[model samples]
Target: MKTPKITIDRIKKYLAEGKRFDGRKPEEFRDLEIEFGVSKKAEGSARVKLGNTEVIVGIKMGVSEPYPDSPNKGNLMVTAELLPLSSPRIEAGPPRFPAIELGRVIDRGLRESHFIDFEKLCIEPGKKVWTLFVDIYTINDDGNLLDAGGIGAVAALMNAKIPKYDEENSRVLHDEHSEENVPLTKERPISITGYKVGDKILFDPTREEEDAGETKVTVGISHGIISSMQKGNETDLDTEMFGEMIDMAEKVWQDLVTKIEKFIK
Candidate 1:
């Protein structure tokens, strides 16, 4: 069922008073918390919290042949599952469109940004290469699932440890005696999300604002470049508003990136 019009009217009144229904300012965001390497079973894992919304990401690396089209590049796969346990709205079984879209967006942001050193994952060229699989699970659905999932995936990837391989045989070997945990390279990318509510904007929206937003812009900022961008809703955005949003995003992105990166194991 949709939110009652009376409730929305109250929210509007609150906004006009420079307050949020959840008791936050127009530009304030909910608290964020992160945990890295939370799972021992996976190669890497992380848990992220944006207010009440929660997400878990796991990274698994294995030996596989590279795709024919991009033989030189290692495989990187991202998938998101909206667990029915997370929220009553989530259906059981296969992933829904929203989950798929979230995964694809995060995947595009990382891959297109060249955040991971795929070339370094190559073992025996096209014959064998390391495949990075990132699995995102929604454990809670208060709101802002997109940002939570994206940050979780990136954190998990950063915390991942590559498996030991036998250079002599060109295969992943079971040599516990000589095994070593190959840490990821030095560089990592960061992402930022901005929401446009009425004529105002905010960084890292709260659960209430996320649900109330008329439009949003998610930008992946990495290595002095705009790695990726996703715009939601058909609401028109003027040049001035767009510029203001971008400016706010950049300022907040610096702090968000620092905090998230610090949790990289």
Candidate 2:
């Protein structure tokens, strides 16, 4: 739903002074909480809450023939479902544009960052490779589901245990898990978003604040390096503003990694 013009004006007014209704700094994020083992049947699963926004991610593994281009590497698939129960803005039906973009942005980040050792997932040089499905479901949509889902994805992957393969039958034994875990490295990529309102850029806006913003940028970063970035809401920005957003992303990344590293490690 669109925000009321009066409310938008009030939000922009507060942003111009570097203030918000919630009394947080423009560069500050809401409280973050992560929970593991949400699904006993899934190879890995986690639930993330960013303030009031909530998302759950599950990892399911299978065996498949390698893709022609990457015959030696395994495959990663990311999908998202924005349930109507999560918010009134979401409908119960096929994925809309936002859901598709969310998955793609997260996938591009994880894929390009080389967070997973795909070579280790390959059971055979050119024939058999493990396939991982990262499924994200929104339980609430106060705001910032994209970043929350990304965090949940990484945490779930970290928690995943590879399932046993029935090589003789060319299938995966979902009921049985192997001692081996998903081949992931120490790299923990995080996604941070900056919302633009007037001349101010803010992180982790509430739903009302998000609705009031003109546009936003989401960056996938690991350490100080950026892996992927996506802009949304059809607003134009200059190079200087983009640079500022990058700076904000890096700082926010550091802040978040500090809070989540204990669980990740």
Candidate 2 lDDT for residue 2: 70
Candidate 1 worst ten-residue window by lDDT: 174-183
> Candidate 1: global Cα-lDDT?
0.75
Best by lDDT: 2
Candidate 2 per-residue C-alpha lDDT over 84-199 given as tens digits, one digit per residue, 9 for 90 to 100: 99999888878999999999999988987879999999999789999999999999999888899999999999889999888898878888877889999877788888888888
Q: List candidate 2 segments past 4 Å from native.
A: none
In terms of TM-score, the best-performing candidate is: 2
Lowest-sum lDDT 10-residue window in model 2: 256-265
1-265 per-residue lDDT for model 1 (tens digits): 4456666566666676777767776655577788987886677789999888899999877788999987777889999999999987777977778888888888888887767878877777778888889999999988778878888987887667776677676666433323334335544455667777767776666555566677888777665567788887778778788888777766666667777766653
Clashes of each: 0, 0
lDDT of all predictions: 0.75, 0.90
